[model samples]
Target chain A: MRRLRHYARLLAVQMRTSLTLAVQYRFDFFLEGALALFWLAITLIPLLVVYSRRESVAGWSFPEALVVVGWFSVLKSVLDGGVTPSLNFVVEGVRKGTLDFVLLKPADAQFLVSTARFEPWRILDFLGSIAVLVYAFHRLGHAPRAGDLMVGLALFGVALILLYSLWILVVSVSFRVVKVDNLSYLFISIFDAGRWPIDVFKGALRLIFTVVFPLALMTTYPAQALLGKLTSAHALLAGTGGLAFAAIARFVWKRALRAYTSASS
Target chain B: MIRARKLCKTYRVHRRPPGLLEALRSVVRRRYEEVRALCDVSFDIAPGERVGFLGPNGAGKTTALKILSGLLYPTSGSVTVGDFVPQDRRTEFLHMITLVMGQKQQLLWDLPPAETFAMNRALFDLPRDEADATQKELVDLLEIGPLIGKPTRQLSLGERMKCELVAALLHRPRVLFLDEPTIGLDVSMQARVRDFIRRYNESTGATVLLTSHYMEDVAALCPRVIVIDKGHLVYDGDLRTLARRIRPEKRITMHFSSLPAPGELDRLGNCVARSELQATLAVPAAQVTEAVRAALGRLPISDISVEDPPLEEIMQEFLGGQPANGGVRSA
Candidate 1:
């Protein structure tokens, strides 16, 4: 119980530090706000162009696919605001040997590095994504059932775990390679595909998105849960899959730490 | 509180030649070379001991400190700190130790140092009152009370280092592994840091293992030192004893009221430095009394003093004369 309190306080302090940093330069807050709105517009343009060509690309209608794009925007906010900044700190830390301070702390080094930085202004993007979700539901002429909302929330958590785990796996590679900016760019490029519904892709691409990289689990499955189109069995599989990815990421992270030869002082 | 038994660390470094053609050709296959950073070196430090780790560049001093602080594992052998294996990095072990590297900083670059201190308090799980008191004490000791509220990016290098020390010590760990803690600081700042470290050690009874490029830092703070050369443990003992053993001669410096007669300065001892106003001579330890007597009688001296050779020269001769595989010595 005491350890739990310690970790909670630790998270709060880390967030506060990041918040203090975020507020230090007032111009950055406004700049980030502008960029967030610009990216949201850019994200919707492709969906608009695709839906304009026909009534639907796959089984998903224009409004239904908007739900997937909503979830994508939400996930992107979490990734950009929380995950990517911290993981990028790790990469820079590895190259500069500043990760020594993280390792010397009494807390788990993984947790410490993962919570090192954040961009609080991403809350604007998050609110915009929620507006998109609400508009999609309004266009459907019905509110989601309470049960569907519960499942959707749970699956949203699962999606976050999957996304964070994949990033962790990418960061673990930094211990050996030391410079992984291109690899990180590659991951970001792949993430761009998550903005589309999973069914739009055929055959091997679908299989890869569903299992290997798990973009389907990250965006499409959660959107399906919200629309009341997902079954319990699929939800169960998503839960188990999320846990498995987390387990694999945890294992790789530990092994990579053991193999870490800190950049020479 | 610290024990290392035949600790060895080796790294397999990737090797690549220069030129775009060589880089393209190396894409097909790469070469690696095993570089031994530490080799069968061992030492035990008692609690509250301030020990200097002396070595030239690439002499494995930082590697040894890293291993002791649990940042790196040895390729072979074992180390225990405060009754726990360092490599295991258990909560208790980490809670009892802290490592600071001068070239790198742990403070948040965009935030004030107070935020970093608060973050450490949470990370170390310290009691609120206790942490506050410790922070207050350290801030006063380092005279950084005014600087902590400013953003770290705005602070000068010396001020940032002082704040870094406060953050590292806020946990009040039992062991400290400091690597070049005063690098790039001006002479006054260096002396202030040294003074703070000595007082901290004396007050807290913590074991400190320090490595620095400045011999004056070592001489002022560490009575005992461990010397490594080419990844070999060359000497470990009292600082004065090591200097005496390495260069067993006294340096006599005399200020002249008038120029000495030709060959007069050489008659007393081997002349080392001679200028128009002053000359220094190296005298054998056994004949120091006779040389001084002869100098006093032979030369017109305005001032005279005798001292051991400078620590820098002693270190140069010690490391320069050591064989590649020199045996370890401890006293």
Candidate 2:
């Protein structure tokens, strides 16, 4: 518990420094917000084109699909904003042996690696996500019950854990592979599949996303909980998957640390 | 206190020739070679002892320091700092030691040095007043009070290094592992860091294990020396003893009033260097008195002095005289 407090303090430092840096380069933050707006605009084009042709997509209404997109946007923002920066830290740390400093510290290495960096400007996307989710709820014309809010939060927490776990598993591969130049690319590409509803994907791809990749649980299930369509069985499965992935991530991290031969050596 | 018993670390590196075809071939048939970074290296250092870890490049000086600092796990044998196993990296062990790598930094690049100090204060769980007091002492010692507020990226190399020292020493660790701590600093800056390190050791009774290519740093700070070459302990004892053993001949530099005849200077000793009205000779330590008498008696010597050879020469002879392909065998 004391170690956890240390991790939190270190993360707070990273967040504060990153925020200060972002404020110094305020134009970058505006540029990122503009880019996000542009992306949202372009993404809405498909929704409009599809909604004009039909009333719903795969038995889901336009606003219902918007919730999925909003959830995905929020998830993407969290991954890109929070987790991706640390991915760069991990790769550079391994390549330059700067990881030695982290390893020598008394804190848990996994916590240190995961929270070593933050890009505060990317929080714009996080805010944008919340805005879109709110707007989508308004469009749906349904007042969400308190139980709905609780389930949405619970599922959202599970989704975040699953995403964090998957990212850790991917980055941990750098320990065995020297040239992880395209590792982040692989992660983003796999995560890209989460942008759309899994029901739109058929057969093998759906199975892969649901079982192997678990991209479906990252955004789709939580959005479903908010939409009042989440089944208890699916929630159980997502929870179990999140726990299993977290366990596997911890195992991989330990194995990778064991395999580490510092750059000087 | 620190102790290591036959501590060894070996790395298996994959080797591939540099070519498109070789790159493709390597994918199918990879080759591996083993490098022994530390081979049966054993040493014991008492508490508060300052030891210079000396060697040529790639001689495993940094490897041994890493092992001692808990950064690298040794392949064999044992290493202990106080009652803690270094590889375990316990909180108490971490609180007791600090490893400062000159080539790398622990300071947050985009943040001010003061921010790193604050972050460390929280991470180390220090009382606020105590942390602040220690920071003030270190900043004043390093004379980096002005540099602490600016972003670390804005500071010059020397300035950043001073702040680096402040960051490392704020915890007041009992054992310090400094690897090339003066690598890229100016001469005066190097001297300042050396002085600061010496002072810190004196004031706190901290054990210091320092590695550097600069012999001056070793001469200035460390009393006893441990020399390793090609991953093996070659000489371990007093620095003066090693220097005397490597080059038993003394250097005799004499300034002549006029250019000496070729035969005249040769008669003094082996001519190491010759110039107009000046010459330097390498005379055996045993014959220094006789050689000095001959030079003073026969030549118009304006000035003459005898001293041990330069440390660079001593190290060169020690490394170059060894077998080319030989691994570090015990001296």
**Model 1 docking tier (incorrect/acceptable/medium/high):** high
lDDT of 2 by residue, B1-331 (tens): 9999998889888898899999999899999999998899999999999999888778899889988988778999899999999888799999999999899998888778888888778667787899999999988888888889998999999999898888888788999999989877888999999999999999999999998868878878998989888899988888888888888899999999987666988887898988898889999999999999999999989999998887766766777764311222211
The residue-level lDDT of candidate 2 at B301 comes to 92
Q: Highest lDDT: which candidate?
A: 1
Model 1 regions more than 4 Å off: B321-331
Q: After superposition, which runs of candidate 2 have C-alpha atoms over 4 Å from their true positions?
A: A1-5, B321-331
Q: Against the true structure, what is every candidate's RMSD?
A: 3.0, 3.3
Error of 1 at A184 (Å): 1.3
Interface RMSD of each: 0.9, 2.1
Give the best candidate by TM-score. 1
Taking the tens digit of each residue's C-alpha lDDT, what string does model 1 give over A117-190?
A: 88898888888999999999998888888999999999999999999899999999999899999999999899
Error of 1 at A191 (Å): 1.2
